[model samples]
Target chain A: MSAAARRGVLPGFGLSTGFTVLYLCLVVLVPLSAVALRSSSLGWQEAWKVVASPRALASYRLSFGASLLAAAANVVFGGLVAWVLARYRFPGRAFVDALVDLPFALPTAVSGIALTAVYGPTGFIGRHLEAAGVRVAFSPLGVTLALTFIGLPFVIRTLQPVLEDLDPEVEEAAAVLGASRWETFRHVLLPALVPAATTGFALAFARGLGEYGSIVFISGNMPMRTEIAPLLVMTRLEQFDYAGAAALATVLLLASFVLLLTINRLQAWTRTRAGAA
Target chain B: MSIVVREVEKAFDATPVLRGVSLEIPDGELVALLGPSGCGKTTLLRIIAGLESADAGEVRHDGEDVSARSARERNVGVVFQHYALFRHMTVEENVAFALRVRRRPRAQVAARVAELLRLVQLEGLKGRYPQQLSGGQRQRVALARALATEPRILLLDEPFGALDARVRQELRRWLRRLHDELHVTSVFVTHDQEEAFEVADRVVLMNAGRVEQVGTPAQVFEEPASAFVMRFLGAVNAFKGWVEGDRAFVSGLDLELVAPASAAHRARAHVFVRPHELDVHRAPVPGSFAANVDRVLPLGAAVRIELSAPGFGGMVEAELDVRRSEALALAPGDAVHLSPRRVRVFPSREDELDSLTASGL
Candidate 1:
């Protein structure tokens, strides 16, 4: 089979590919191409000067660092939540599951305000933490906290179905065959949940990277220290520096695309492994 | 090793699954827990394996009470009907799973797994995954895996129930031979009476969460303890009769037979006789009741003649070999004489026994 036809495992190959390209052009490619055109109009030397300034680098650091931290936190906590929901039966399970998706339904602006009120220096539980000299709101840490809050649901929701589909009999069979609970989970459960967890991680990371509304409210928008890539893009747009904004947007878009590709590869690899076995 | 289950009772919610179930499975003996579906046979096997906890009972293996022990600690092997083979592993890895989990020495694990694969006659297929193997091959792999740990007792829950007719029959003989060679105390749960009769050294027939009869295959077939057992064993031609003095008088037909023992106490009774045991001759034989053949079904090797005798309200199934059927020259609507050799007398209280037999529990 030809290379193009070989990737035709998905149904209605030509039609789906055409639709996917059209959708990408409408939603992503056209806007991204416009951004690149604007950036190029500044000429290579001028674009580099705007993108590599110390403040731009600092914003890059804060944005990438906070996103990584938030994504890492989601991986651990989301796995725990998925395990509990999948492996055990408890009262209010449906309600707990519904609560996990609350972030998806709630407006980001509303979530940002809620987080600030709950964790700000003079707010409810924040007063005690503030008394201890541990600040949460209007800081880099607050940005991370807000990102974590928005990114958590992606991981848990992605993994819950996979975890539920895992056969309990496999674990029992492992145990009877002499493996302890830890061994069973390590050998039988973890291998199956890994691909799902990786997909969740990538999704959360991508979401955290481009996050604007929630982090902007919590970070206090201090340039060089608190401002992120998305904020910088917004700043450039406000100052009518469309070329600089496009350059920054291009970087975020490329990183997100790479991460999504990796996630797709991981999902395919996992399915093949599961099917072969 | 011998397994002793004492007064075992299990209940799910408010319904009892197994009640007052007790049995002794001697070492190296293949005991079959045979009953129809919902008969609690599988529950009894699970209880012995410590997979299901008995509400009130003690499970002892080799003189040690294993009631408090988990399934792993009980050292029992179970092969489910679905095989439940680990699809993620190859045949060798699946067989070696038990050893690997116990953290046995690497050399020993490899050697033992190799040996087990050879025993199951899948040496060439060791590297193949379960999905790559046939249905029969997967089951053999499951059996090899179960036996990997050198279990004290092996439990099989309808292992061949999922196989095709030809494979099921072939596996039964192979399993009997394997049990003899291994000499391990094994208990298998099966709803198929023929399977139990063919494979088990002793068959334990269960009905309604209770042991209806426990005996050798011939014993159970010849002397079923209850009316339920007689019917469940095979198709029986039943004759409702009343006992007077030493004889049982047929209700509708002018027929009488001397009661054997304890038959006089029951005012009304039903006699059980196997279909093949009824002699059908072309001529009106002596001391035989005349019956009109309603239909004749030619099953490949055997012919079944449905007869409506005067005494029995419903038709009775009478089996005859093709040759015997040819000699009789029986056809639909033909008049013939059916003389049953021996019949079992069951009390009228056994009328509800049909429901019990049908439910198999």
Candidate 2:
């Protein structure tokens, strides 16, 4: 018998497996490997120097730090938004629900320009804020704000279904057992929501790290300040330094992949613990 | 603690769910709110538990009015139909939740959790999560969790409704024993009449958002207050007829029904008979109706005979012991006689009698 015939009851197992592996390699692995190979041609010492320069290091810190801050803010406010969308009914609820996906559906560059217009020094809400000695545009905070705007939908969308599926009976059960509303939330509801919320946080954070279009318009791109790693890679490419751009892109890709993998593992752990319970 | 619910009324979006529901549950009594789905039994239980508020009513615990209090303030415990164990917690943690939420000492929480685990016979599975346990075990965990704080009253909403028949039976017996041991003022809602009769001290029958009757198992089973209760108790046959001269003159049956003395003057009535109370005979007899056997079904210990009379539009059922049915050799098209050993007659309300006859009962 042929190996394919002996594989299982299902037919064409070998052919399907071969196709799947080939498709993944061509679509995902090959492009990623090309970046690594191109960066390798620069020689390790030069590549290291390029990625670890004072300017490059500052950009790295701003990119990762702003992404972290944006993800943290989204976890709080995005969770509230998701909870409201899932649990309550108010005027324009359907409209507001549709609006959550605006970040995902709007062109990133359009959102960037819109956010800049709204939060610019002379803009609608920003004029009052600037007079109050707060600046949201053309700074590191502006970059973070832009990232937050783009990342909002990731967290809300991820947590919405999980929140909706959470049984209200359990909360009522807790209340009837003498837990106050806060206690019921903290002890019963929060524990069930944590895994999904963490997954959302990770997703939002990953999206923020790679965000380029939205940040470029709002961020002033000042070296060692508002400049982010993706912008630094783009600058390198514009300067005709392919190896430097490839190295920077490879570093961002590896860092994000590692962090996202760790977060995914954390989410899986929580899910398993919840399943076991 | 004893509970008294006074004329509780509730509505959902203008559709009335509970209409002036009132009941008194004395301390240490286990009552079952029995009804079909959508009858508002579960809603009434929720009202008493303080999980839901009545539009107009007062709920009192031990003579203290708690209508304005929240569920947390009322100190009640509720077990949901699907167990509702916290999926993120271990069995021990779920049982300990009430105490822990109250900020009880760690040692005290541990001790109480251990005690409850033992009570629920789940000591060995304390560290396991709800998903790791079988349905029966999850329900036991839910029960233990509810009982953790020693709440004055415990409410369960169709506690075994999610389990299969075998597991449901096992859990029913376990719940009966647990109630005996705890003796908390408890009320559980269930649609299963057998479960209600077997497990509850008293059964409160409900229909169409109204309390039909409240009595002990025997009382409700033997002397249902209304035709609705009689039919809901299951395996019942209703005959639309008139009662006069101490006999019920049914439309289709040739035999005369022995009506209760009090029902003798009623011009119109609905007479009900349970299948088991009916006897099937090979030869026609006085006070018995002639019927043609439509089918014979062996139901484990007994045989159910489906019969149809010439003039009766609907079929009547009779159950006989397995061995006796075998000796009689009853079959389809065989001529037989049926005599009801027990019957209940209620004065026919115009709407109810119309519905009963329209349903071909």
Candidate 3:
């Protein structure tokens, strides 16, 4: 046996490694590079003008801001849902557990239509909200609602297994050590849960940042307010400004990449702290 | 603190787990709840810890009724079988948890944690997490954490059940020394009889959701209270016979043994003895029966001789010291005389008074 043959534990390492790299390039890198290549055709100043336009800036704020708000909301309520599903039993528990995956299964357009019917003015919930002077559809809040709807399953699914695997004996130990229920939860349970919860938060936030279909109907695509970056890119495409659309797409992709990378670093730091503790 | 449990009965769903169990633990005494699996020993321990509520019972600590008190308010520290250390907390933090939760002064909490860490001899590893520690080290950390609050009573649920034999033995001795220094009223549950005998001042033997016997280790071993306790304490030989007047006649062999007056009233009785109490002789002797040696097993310090008599229904076993076995030079198929040194006679189950009287035979 030569040294090269024994380099990896598995046989055919070279062939498998080549195939993985080729498949990744063909499927992911090539398409992403095309967007960059198209944007680069325009001069740097022209590309900056397109991406830094006031309209584009407002879209960026709404997109990132609403996604952050929705992900935050999911981290709170989605965590509660996961906890209940993992630790308790009640009537309709199985049904509710299955319903958590609805956003993953439902078509985004159909969910958009349904959410609009329920929260739009004169609709089931919107009529009551309208009487109180609160509007949901055709607003930034509506965009957040749509994002929240799509991002819930990510948080819940990521957190469910971690919560279930937490030993109940630890809680009992805390209690028997003279800690109150709230104290036990704060000092014992929450620290163990933080890393997994942060991972779930990052996943939901990344998913919400790029969301488009459900927000189209609920957000009404109002420029300078409800228009999201994905919708802005579509608007540029519709006007036959392919370079401008690619420029905006490249900017959104880079911003998301940076944000996701930061989140990954944060997650890694938390995991190391937890492990070192 | 002394603890008293009065008729602590509990049932899970439709299955009864503890059936009217009662116990008393004096202050600073170490007691062991010994039983086989599914025998309600752990359940009883949990009930006393206030982790589980009894269907009908009262628990009192230091003469105050604590039946309705929550586990958090009971001021009892529990060390779980698996230690249950907070995986995300360092050892110092874990030990400081109780004091911190109670809103004690920072310096006081730190001093107490340091004191406990030193007491458990884990002072240097205070910054390490639970996963970084070995099983025995984790157990010591757990002990420190449990003692941090200065609890009135301590409960351990099979503390060394998860460790290997070597670590288990070392920790058992360490626990005994720690218990003496702390002098806190403590109770622990274990199914291993040897562990219970080795560590506990008194052992509470339980079976079928009830306590079969409660006594010091020496008392329980030398004088078992019931047939279950006798068999549970290593009684391996049984002889069935009918008692008449002052003697019990063996059914298969031509032998007769003295019987108590109470045993003479029973139509059928079982004589139980430990293997070491049965003596083997090379020739048939008075009050001894002839048997053929079926097998010889060599244990580390003792030799187990399996013997069988002609027309006997079951095999008989006798244990002899290795030196004595070597002196005798016994082998399989050799004829020998077997005599019992001591035996306990109890009425057989099938010959209960109701069955015997109802059949009118």
Q: Which of the two candidates, 2 or 3, achieves a greater TM-score against the reference?
A: 2
lDDT of 3 by residue, A16-119 (tens): 87899999999999999999999999999999999999999999999999999999999999999999999999999999999999999999999999999999
Find the candidate with the highest lDDT and give its number.
Answer: 2
Provide the DockQ value for model 3.
0.72
* Candidate 1 wrongly placed segments (more than 4 Å): A2-34, A275-277, B243-249, B254-261, B282-294, B307-311, B350-361
**After aligning candidate 3 to the native by TM-score, how far in Å is the CA of A120 from where it should be?**
1.3
Q: List runs of model 3 lying over 4 Å from the truth.
A: A1-20, B244-246, B253-261, B308-310, B350-361
**Per-residue lDDT tens digits of candidate 2, residues A62-142?**
999999999999999999999999999899999999999999999999999998899999899889989999999989999
lDDT of each: 0.84, 0.88, 0.87
**Fnat of each prediction, in sequence:** 0.35, 0.95, 0.87
Candidate 3 TM-score, true structure as reference: 0.94
Q: Count backbone clashes in candidate 2.
A: 3
TM-score of each: 0.91, 0.94, 0.94
Give per-residue CA lDDT, model 1, range B91-186, as digits (tens). 888898888888899999999999998888999999887888888888899899999999968999898988999988988998999998999999
User: Which CAPRI category fits model 3?
Assistant: medium
Q: What is the interface RMSD of each candidate, in Å?
A: 1.8, 1.3, 1.5
Ranking by TM-score: 2, 3, 1
lDDT for each residue of candidate 3 in B88-205, tens digit (9 for 90 to 100): 8889988888888888999999899989999999989999988899999999999898888898799999999999999999999888988999899999999788999889999999
